[model samples]
Target: MKQRAITGLFFIIVMIGSNLLGSYVFSVFYLLLSLFCLLEFYKLVKQGGMQPERFTGALAGVTLFFFFAANCYFPAYKYIILLPILLSFIPIGELYKKSEAPFTNIGFTYLGLLMAVVPFMFFHAMAFTRGDGVFNFHVPLGFLIMLWSNDTGAYLVGSKFGRNKLFERHSPKKSWEGFIGGILICAFAAYILSNFYTEYNRFDWIIMSLIISNFGTMGDLVESMFKRSLNVKDSGGILPGHGGLLDRFDGLLMAAPIVYAYLYLISN
Candidate 1:
């Protein structure tokens, strides 16, 4: 318990510091982290007895990362979307040659890319577009704070008063009490932050908070499903108490795109 707490604090500090730095640096860091995560995911796929082309998959993953980075840094790069379609054939070819269940490999690989890379691109895009500093630091940091508030609230409340399960099969430890607590805390954070923003109204920020918190929880569950399927405890041992990069950003993975879309749709 003591180790976990210390690890958690250290993780938070590093994350907060990185987010404060802004978009280009954040995107660069994201690209590198995503590469590591992609490596871990590919390792999992290989372990599942699927013969996915590792080099091809890694290349495709890196391509996907840059494509997303382009989506943020250069919106005019419409050709970026086509990259996925083109690379989709690599997995498809592997699926075609399989004597057994080829589709599973192809599907898992594709889904992994979507689950891991696409939303992160959206996050990068959001970070770049929303702020006006060296790296558009404020938007990403605000988003992180919102996510952290939700996570902290859920942990504190769920540990104390949780009884009803949110989804026992996927995440046995989470409860409805914790879920609501997290949402309320996130909503409060949103309200508080809204006062500083002239662009979004109180209701808008609150809605964004709810979307982030709820989907973030679901995202964590989704990652849990992957880990459970692989029969592993944590995704990786990158963070001391936090498990892997994937484990730390599972919520952000889903929440980032949602927040980006919210800003894109409503604010724009």
Candidate 2:
């Protein structure tokens, strides 16, 4: 418990610091994080008897992140097309290797991209598009705020009020009551954030928070299911008591891209 508390505090500080440091630091820091999460995903998949092209996949994930980030800032970097060309190495390299389940390896390679890469790219994109070309910490910071609030609220509410299991097969501890409590808490947080941010109104922030809460729960469940299939308790021990990058950021994985879409829709 001490370890968990310490790790969580440290992570929160670094996250806040990164946001304050502006776009470059945030992008570089999270790109490294994306790479770590991608590597962790490969490690977990390997334990499940598939040999994903970790190097190629990590490279591709990293490149894809930079590709979108560059496109966001430059808006003229046609080099973005090079990402798919780079990812082609996954299958092309697999063809040369002597593996019984080459296609399975290839599948996991792309799965890493879908699960971790693109969402991170979406997050990077969000950090840049605040309408002034300056780094807007609100979108990404608000995301963290919403995500953390949901986790905290769900835990507190579920421990006292949990009765019906949300998904007993995948996550027995999760409850529908907890989920509802989380959404309410996130909506409340969004309302508070709206006062401070003011770029987006209260209702939009609440809607964004709702999207994060709903999809964030799905992300957690999906990671839980992924681990169940792999027969692992935690993703990795990289963060001491917090499991791994994938475990910590699972909410962001599914939530980021969809939230990006929602924000785009409302903005337009």
Instruction: Tell me how far the alpha carbon of residue 79 in candidate 1 is from the true structure, in angstroms, after superposition.
Output: 3.7
Q: Which whole-number lDDT from 0 to 100 does residue 192 have in model 1?
A: 89
Where's the lowest-lDDT run of ten residues in candidate 2?
A: 125-134
Query: How much is the lDDT of residue 133 in candidate 2?
Result: 57
Instruction: Residues 1-268, candidate 2: write the lDDT tens digits.
Output: 9999999999999988988897889889888988988999999999999999999998899888887776666674678778778988899999889999999999999999899777788887777665445678888999999999999999989999999899999999999999999999999999999999987888888888988999999999999999999999999998989998998899997889988887777766
Cα lDDT, model 2, residue 241? 90
Per-model TM-score versus the true fold: 0.87, 0.97
What Cα-based lDDT does every candidate model obtain? 0.77, 0.88
Best by lDDT: 2
Which candidate leads the pack in TM-score? 2
Model 1 steric clash pairs: 23-135
TM-score (C-alpha, index-matched) for candidate 1:
0.87
